[model samples]
Target: MKPRFPIPLLVPLLLSVALAADDDFSFDFITHGPMLGEVTDSTVKVWARSQRPGEYAVRYGTDPASLDQVSAPLKTTIEHDNTGWVTLTGLKPETTYHYQVYHDTLPTGPAGGFRTLPNAEEHREPEHNPRGLFNFSFQFGSCANQNPNHGIGPSLPTHATMRRTLPGKALFSIMNGDFIYEEHRTLPVTNWLSQVGLTPGESPEIVKLAPSVVGLWENYKTYLSRGVNLAAWQRNMPTVFTFDDHELVNDIRGAGTTGFRERRAVFRDIGIRAWEDYAGWACPRATSQGIHFGTAKLEEGSDILTDKDADFSKIDLAQAANLHVHWGTDSAGVDDIRLDAESPANPNAGVYDVLEVLDAHRLRVTPAAVADSTGSYSIGRRSHGKFTVSNCDFFLLDCKTHRQMHDPKEPGKKGLTLLGDRQKAWLLEEMEKSGADFFFVVSSVNFMIPHNGAGGHEFAEGKDEAWTSMLDERERLIDAFDALRKPVFILTADLHNSFAIKITDRVWEFASGPLNSVNHVPKNDEGDRPATGLFRSGPRTCDIRWSSYILPDLERLQRLYPYYCVAQINNVFNMPKELGGTRWVAYPNPQVIFQYFDGRTGAFQYAEAIGTERKP
Candidate 1:
């Protein structure tokens, strides 16, 4: 029997890396992780961070005793905050492999192993069946902040529970979003005083101002080290992460027009860079290149471009920032500033790059002719992406980027965008082309449900952060799913409660976790269909299957408990043989069973099943 690893009460800093005096911040030598990611039939990426620059490698094999295979040594540099990944390849499909990390000659963390996904081709057979069915299971949830002041727990207990309960059964964990929330605003560091390890009432002047990059790095380091349970879970189970607002800043809308363009520009470049170092290296990227673009209104008749709040070309574009720009024509001229790579006038047309950073905010570009007036200036580049597993395609939508400010009155207008035109198109095309048995669309925010009653079930009013504000895009995506006639599971998070809503006969939406975030009371006004309980919430457009929030006295009932949804998928549904029958019959219909469990008591809170019926 495999020995059960004990959960540590306090998260120990990994090993010493670098040290700073002001905040007394330091990174461990083998800091935080030797976690797994990007696991496929024959490949898995092992990611780890170090306090110092050095070459690191991983030893692996099917047996824990022999552990014969060794990966090529990869170097960790201070440039990337001493983080990197070494991918192990030539692995056997559907086989389990054990691994141990090496800091040069010495082994680092505990031994860990994971089972590779089944080969896609293996599902087919000539004798028993021509088309084979793929089967697998995974657990998913989101919104975990290990900060005590946030009213969430000091550590992620749910991950420990998942690691304990699921064991070798779950293929990988899907961290839908909000992996870290400690990196709040940095213009002046709004929430710095409340951060852990800070002196009480530390003078704002004494606190070092961290650039978005450093700030994000510090948060990841702190969260990973402090997240003892999360650390324990990731060592064995790979996690696919997508970003929500908190990953960048609280309630960030990458493409929204309302925020300060300068800050958005800074966050995009820094945040993406930090995310790549910490999370993106292991995940598949969107075809759109994870590019996030937005337009800023230009000053009229003035050569200097300025919005109601910011000056164009003044947003800080970091070194190594890959950015493109398209200057728009007058509003009356109907500027063709759309992100059309085919249009010569469009910056994304691939002609001009951000020439040079004159300073922090000001930039220099060629064809100086137009430091002149314009309607709007569009700027964007590659950002976050998605991944897949087995015959299931996981389209983890880049919700943070490419979102536009929605007009509640004209919700269906072209201007209202959540998954920008490019991403939406990519999704539809991919879904249409995929031969997968199921499609799991992961959105960091609730898809069709509202968080508050302010907009009365449809719009969240001023908050463009949630899908409730992007009703038009929601409908369009739903239509696309309905057309496919496949089993589409829209798994969502960030609302801080678990919910299940049936959008159609073949499509459903499951909002999963808070993992460890503060409690957000579910409300009847959040949606149209209340599941006949205290905290039920679901869209009126469809029936709600179940809502964990609906339990009586929900707020006081289980406030500290974290939650998760484990989903099992199978290609066939079996009908037991009747009393006189000789054998059971198998239907090609793919079925998915979702089990929601509370972390505190390991109690089963709810379960729901859905499947695509095989045609007669």
Candidate 2:
């Protein structure tokens, strides 16, 4: 200033300062690894995503060094809102290939790599696929919360470690649910941002983002950034993900009209957006548009509201006043007033319809909603639409959507329902028609019986009785499997513990412990008897094996009677504090091999000529 520098020199100095400022701007570009899908002899589906939006490209080859040899261009698309995902196809089976994804423009940012699954048909020989051989080795877990103080944040590092340790071997990983803890706003996002050293004012772009979605996106980003271990895993492996309660508001009933419906709707939109962004691509257009209810049957004499009839714009002042008086007010007073004033003879037959015009308008505006009250059930043709993945039929059941009356006297809670009659029929039909070898039923909550508490282990208390009411349906579904006798394995992760249960005519169940949480095995002296009497009699009726790995601290395993193994990883010896974590000990892996068992004696004394392969 004193020297009065030339205008050209001043311009250069300003430009350099601006460049430096831009360079100092801190942002995160977390990547979710390559997930395998649509596997076949010739090709398989490989997908990946990053936090930031940009052109995504994938380069692949058998050799890690020469990934350029089999490089393929990929198109990144938006799913929920901000998460960027890409899928690569036409990969050969049983081949090892390395892949790297780079932003089209921000080339300087991080680029990760992953491998694909083998061709299912290629493993013809026993040697090639040994005993207990699985075509794929996948690691799936759920119930991860964002804990910044722990450094792992919301996502589990052990799963990532397992993926990295396995390297080119892991086919895929499934994040069953609770991918983020956004809905529970007890932990403020601002606090999280502060922990991450992010100033709120610096990133004005995030201000426009929805709180739930922002929380989820931030948690995901934090995992990617803080997950130095997970980054290594993602660079080598891909993950397939699904949402549970935490993804949206916890325990949301999609079709129900509870007070939280509006909040749930918002949560669903934001959750799906965050899911599409952080996870791989999900085509939820059908779900998003509420098209799944097209085939839903209505209960007789029920008021079925439709988008057109219940449209906010359609309600005139009189119609709105009538609705407010009838539905908005208490039901008790209306029944008495209508009985005494309108119909003196029949008190029970209270004001069923406020106005014939409303009913007629409902019929014209929303025929589906009108038909819903008719008691005649409808079953829409089972179509996967966009949510289906090849070789796997995902029955993402709507267990939490409907509210059913519950009885308190039942062993478990009486309110839970596995499926309404219509959904049950559709599910059976789908199962019967399914061509895939494995049917992966993704339920947010546990489908199997709970061991800890009776009365269905209240996840949402009074509002969640519908989930507990379906014991009969659960048994019926199990019976269907017993009748069809097809190979079926159910994956659920709401219990915060990992378990593998073998459900047959004879109850042969095996449960795994939680990867996180406190490890507490029921001591024999504690007298926590087995629920199905499978523990006392022997391993015949059920072979239940439970294990828990509480990182950097403990690991324990317990089998019913003949064998129980427990191992704890403590820093007692000359081991590093970080790697001193313990893992549960067990002789046989808990995977069911479809063997015969003695229900009466609880014994597996006979051997069958069945081809059982281990899951690698």
> Which candidate has the top score in TM-score?
1
Q: What is the lDDT of residue 244 in candidate 2?
A: 60
Q: In candidate 1, list every pair of residues with a backbone clash.
A: 15-28, 15-29, 16-28, 16-29, 17-27, 17-51, 123-132, 290-383, 314-361
> 1-616 in candidate 1: lDDT tens per residue?
6435333522222222222432232322477588888788889989988765568789999889887888988678655667888889999988988898886566776668788887656654543335555577888999887767444565677887887888767888888888887443332233433333234454332122123355677778777787788888888897788877667655544343433232332244346556777877667665333322333323323222223433434444431223323322111111121321122232221112455544433444432323233322434443445566645788878776567655645544655777766677778898999887788998888876675432122223444345777776787788789889888999998776778888778888998887887655544434443653332222236666687554335454355557889999766432334665322223456578998889665689888887775688
Shift in Å, residue 233, candidate 1 = 0.9
What shift in Å separates residue 265 of candidate 2 from its native position after superposition?
A: 8.5
Candidate 2 residues lying further than 4 Å off, grouped into runs, are 1-52, 69-81, 104-113, 120-134, 146-157, 182-211, 251-269, 280-426, 435-440, 451-469, 500-502, 506-513, 519-616
Candidate 1 lDDT score relative to the true structure: 0.63
lDDT (0 to 1) per candidate:
0.63, 0.39
Backbone clash count, each prediction separately: 9, 34
Q: What TM-score does structure 2 among the candidates reach?
A: 0.58
lDDT of model number 2? 0.39
Worst 10 residues of 1 by lDDT: 328-337
